[model samples]
Target: MPSKKSARLAALTVAAVCSAASTVVLTAPAHADSVRIHDIQGSTRISPYAGKQVTDVAGIVTGVRTYGSSRGFWIQDPQADDSPLTSEAIFVYTNSTPKGVAVGDAVTVSGTVQEYVPGGANTGNQSITEITKPTFTVVSSGNAVPAAKVIDAKSVPAVYSPQGDTAAGGSVNGLTLEPTKYALDYYESLEGENVQVADTRVVGATDPYSELWVTVKPWEHRNRRGGTVYGSYDSQNTGRIQIQSLGKTADFPVANVGDVLEGATSGPLDYNQFGGYTLVANRIGTLKSSGLQRETTQKQSRGELAVATYNVENLDPSDATFAEHASAIVNNLQSPDIVSLEEIQDNNGATNDGTTAADQTVQKLIDAIVAAGGPTYDWRSIDPVDKADGGEPGGNIRQVFLFNPQRVSFTDRAGGDATTAAGVTKVGGKAALTVSPGRIDPANAAFANSRKPLAGEFVFRGKTVFVIANHLNSKGGDQGLTAQFQPPARSSEVQRHAQVTALHAFVKDILDTQKNADVIALGDINDFEFSDTVKILEGDGALWSAIKSLPKSERYSYVYQGNAQTLDQILISPSIRRSCDFEYDSVHVNAEFNDQISDHDPQVLRFRP
Candidate 1:
């Protein structure tokens, strides 16, 4: 588990990596007796000896999934096998290269059993993956799985994704989400893992590359599955996996609407979304999406704009998501003209319909905003996702800025310093892929999952204030959290330091050119006054935190256990620092996102000349 500090720093982020290979291949899972595995992680403590290399360990083929040439199948451990925590059938995978396999086909799998800490984001797939040692292969003469009717987590059901059908039917089995297991750990890993799952009704195949999502126990594992999200963080990762399946029953061979899925084992991938660590999977399947809906047409009057940040804690936008969450986000902090939000996910639009549950929806957030009845914020903006965006395979996570556009002009095609679309696309110019940080090069290198600062020039006051939105490195404090300039900390600390250093450089560059420039560095910096990165930035004349000059209670934006500390921040440049009357308003560092959309609340800085 990541430390409290790390989780807060980069609640959202990704870095670019060096090079990734296209190697993805796996023979099949060897079906043997029902072997039981227990206390998985505890047992597999990496030792100096034992089966030194990859071996053939087979169990019952619980699941199978195919993605391009990359394929995977899950082998169930009887829950009593004495093995490393890793060996206990959580999730496993091949190299980035593709493989050949189909659903329900049991065969022998020969791969190395690794004993080490998985160095990446947690998506419930493999805490670790093994390089195949190539063992013998065998096919099962067993029966085939029955046709599944793809269900969702809602009370009602639909035929395909709300967007309608395609060459690859967007049908899928469902999953119930939970806060503990999935949301915290497993949920993060779903971005891109070639999972070997049994009994999923292959919904939509857009082209030669098919699209699919895995399912767990539908309806019961919402946090574990369901919503569309991406988790890859950098060059080290390249895929996204959705809960086409989560919790399923053993007896229910015939999947019905809202039926839970069982018999599933997944493989980790080399390519992943953003994580302090990298996801290494051969191939990733596309999860269906209800897509995004941006409404920029409403008229607006500009005056006082209130910018706030809320955790929205695991908001699904589904019919049952907090049912009471609507009011919490409405905000008492000045009728919000532009509010930055976190943790809201995509559920199928129109919860009012007689649908059992939602698969993925773009309107979910919009509906939540409306449910708040700002009555004042009738005008808004949202990114309408298409068949792409991979339907948020890592669960609902993405920092969103809600403004009138009347208030803030969005740089539609603004992002990335990568090859094309700037940093938007990953995996060889895939038009609609998530972007990791590390754009305009800096002296400090930026890798995947290290949250990069998002910059935008916002016209505030008569002049433009350079806005650099940031969610630093989270998860065990960036593995890089040591005293960059100390000894013996995970390299994660190094990653975060690099991230902050790059951010500082970027801000410095912006300031160098603009004589009277005002740069506001906001959002979970994840560091404090004494932290290495913060010290470096402060040393630079870059900026200072608004909370630095506030009362103790007002200094904190998040509370861990019982200790209140300031994680979210509002840093301003020298010029901007002395330009306004700033007050730090702390809402609820003690509250969860039922009303609190995220783990960190907004640090309100009321600055007026």
Candidate 2:
């Protein structure tokens, strides 16, 4: 039952240096020689003079931050370099409060130039060039601030990364930067320098920490809902940048996708551990309306029963996403007759109280749907052994069902519990669940610490339909693409394959019992539709992936980095597929927007019962 505010906030400390309004004056020394900031911060990622001692580097103190582990101040030369690829500012890492320096004080510092990686050097992350062990003498105070360079949509490059291995193969921590064509290079060129973007559009939803993301190149690589599509390798969209209030006079305004920044966004460009190339703003424009509205689909006809599956992302009663989720189910999804829900948490959420029941949570969602002008839906699920189901500790995330009693009726039977496996049998020439709302082979070793599939029986318009809701093992332990291994092993799929095999066998058993039985298995499968895990799920054509019926470009239900991928699906039996009456819709309410309540979007299937 974790809330949407679960994303960790970036931590920062208050500055102990001079205020932005400080003004003082002093005379410069009689020395005529000095080192330039651009020479210390070269055109490349690494400084040319790194690990060497330098004397008398002069600049105006633009910022002084004396409050953190890497305590430092930023200084910029009033006379900037002619090349756009070279930056004029460099950070002087004091590691403590320096005695005679403050913002607006033009000074000369003597120190050793070094490149420090925020994390470890082996983490494949970029490094920051800094001046450390510094002694400085103030020459003058309250000098005029250097004019900030303006960076707008036209100045940004369309390419996301440099070509080939020369740019570290598009790695986030790459060492090479091609400022002419790469987005990463464009941002790196202005590190620690103040810049501005005008008439921009907010792409991501504002987070609990009051930060958001915006796109300067709004039309390029745009998705249907106005988000810049993020893709891997050469197709990556390099337009989006994170907005923070670190250098701002006020906090960033809460914004949704398509909202405009009417005045302009001006700030210092920074790179950090959480996300790269963030624009830390001190002043932002007023938010203007984009007139964006929530979408709703057409309701199902008399002959068709609409079924949907949604992963609510660890929902609990305390979560505020329930109302928006209910609106999605009612308006966006058109009130599907039966819905499969994943990640339903226990009543106390992550309190670890040993309680396994989710009645309060399920009731809250049902009430929300009813309040949103949908039917009064009934729910069915078996509580798992305390903490046995994998999720947030003590939360016991599991799958459950919400069925509209006015359109469908649950077939209740006997002999089913958390550990007892459900079986199929023939009843009046149709397949029937031996135990209504039962677990499918709950004792099987393949489902250890994972959500055991919840099977149920239902009748719509005098026709029987069987469904098994599932939330399989995630892609947690797999090695990333940038791992030490060349083709990073997806070992997490071994367990998912085993889980899919069990599910495939269950569908085969039911089809063997009655050849014409209508069966569907749907939820977050945690693998691509064309992946080996899905290949095993469709073993020998036992069940076909209904999502393949969609166009190749439209088959996605989730977007990661910039690639449109599918991690949720609905697979159906041959009997249901042969009729050709099934219609599928990967509703686009959630995945494309930053204001989305869930990370995964819901998929709907409509067919004659």
Candidate 3:
């Protein structure tokens, strides 16, 4: 789903008729008394009166939104209706800031009913019922607003959504909503109506866009650090709701995970493109900080080797996060012997000037680590072709290995370049890489427009170890959990599955040559631990993800839309896992904090070879 601001900008550019003040006349006008708000809403996800004009729909103004491209006011009918399946309120889009509408004003609006789908229909998002090109007259002033319907843990069903009808192309748009059976249906039933959630926990921190996420059910899949864990696809945390403010952006609270929104947070329930259902709040609650602190992992012993993986989130030479990232590596991670860094952008980041070198970027980070009282690290990586890899254009993001020479030594072999393929061979009856810091099958179709895996050889205490670093294809084009298609399609997984298959075969080549060889593959896998991508990488017992060794509640290294999930992982071979003497920790430092240097938390693995 797209962000609300981006969706609004798209609307402003594409839909010109929405900005007109004249009445938009549709096919035929309906009788004033026959077309109630509920009658227009019907009992389905789409409005029954869409693309038709309705006259004199009476309601009281519940909230007024004067910001963004989609400026509108919500009107709710005070008169009660018996059915709980239809909404009593509707948004009257005024195109610009509404002039004479107040929160307590009673108005009768006459306009064309439109089903506005944010981010367009191809995104599979549920459409929002709105009365566009509206003309309204105030009937009364200073009237009481309708009572807000409370939404809590008991009201939301455990089941996330219903299976879409096969006849309708796997869309639940035409089916009648069952508010009691499914959580998505329950939210659809209250669309455009005034709602409230009391004393909720902040699961996602306040992002740069001034929006945060909260969960009504505080205890559902709650982690030790007060986050809702998304263990699997079947267990979607249905209590999550995105919150945006109608007030000024400066007035929005700055909150971290585990904080509390004390008192009543009341607003009109809206469906947007970013997160499925959102609360466009007129009255936000007071923030109570929980004092959630960053976590630090125990340092590795003299006999043990510590290796870590961290995605710096597109680090460049000009980024201000260098010092903070250095502190995180030295203090929080306890200075791992070998670190696999992902998204290390070129020196001229995102400039598209055909520059493909990242020596300046890497050297700046090494300097920062030394300034932070850490080891003097040596680095090795192959520069990618300009604009060939995916990510910000001209960034040429690739994986790099940073090793502390005092504790470990890198074996450098020549003849590795951007387009060459690395192979495995045997040296002294031990598995060895032909070209150290060489790419694995760089020209394969599976790695097209994506980062290729980098393989390196390291020696720790006279023991040889093979490390493969990867940043797989991202989950950019997949459908959301609240998509109209039930069991939403993961189209992005096709390329990821192919990439992991190639990776699995490469790992097998080494293990087949030497059955007991020690290998550690780590980085941002960009898929869940239980996903097919991970399973393919672990094919035929060639490797195993170390994240599964920890308890279920402590497996996540990323927080997305209030669901604590896993996108980064470290996998070990039979030589490491079979010994059963390794420790894995997903350090929780950045993902849960408001002042974050990166969106992903680092993962550390410690073991003696």
Top model by lDDT, which number? 3
TM-score of each: 0.41, 0.77, 0.95
Q: Write the per-residue lDDT of candidate 2 for residues 1-609, one digit (tens) a residue.
A: 112123112211122332121111112233323468888677776677766767768787776654445566777888887887778878787766655666777766778676675544444445666777776666667886677777777778876554334344444433445677766677778887877777788776566556677777777666665555433224445677777664432455767666788777765676654445667665677888676665566689978989899999999999998899999999999999999999999998999988999999999999999999999999999999997879899899999999999999999988878999999888887788899999998888889989999999989998889998999988876643323222345778998999999999998999999888889999999888888888899898878889899865567677543345678899988888999998998887776565778878899999996
Give residue 12's lDDT in candidate 3 (0 to 100). Answer: 24
What do the candidate models score in CA lDDT, each in turn? 0.37, 0.76, 0.90
lDDT string, candidate 3, 519-568, tens digits? 88899999999999999999989999999999999989999999999999
TM for candidate 3 is 0.95
Candidates 1 and 2: which is better by lDDT?
2
Clashes of 3: 0
Ranking by lDDT: 3, 2, 1
Cα error, candidate 2, residue 348 (Å): 1.6
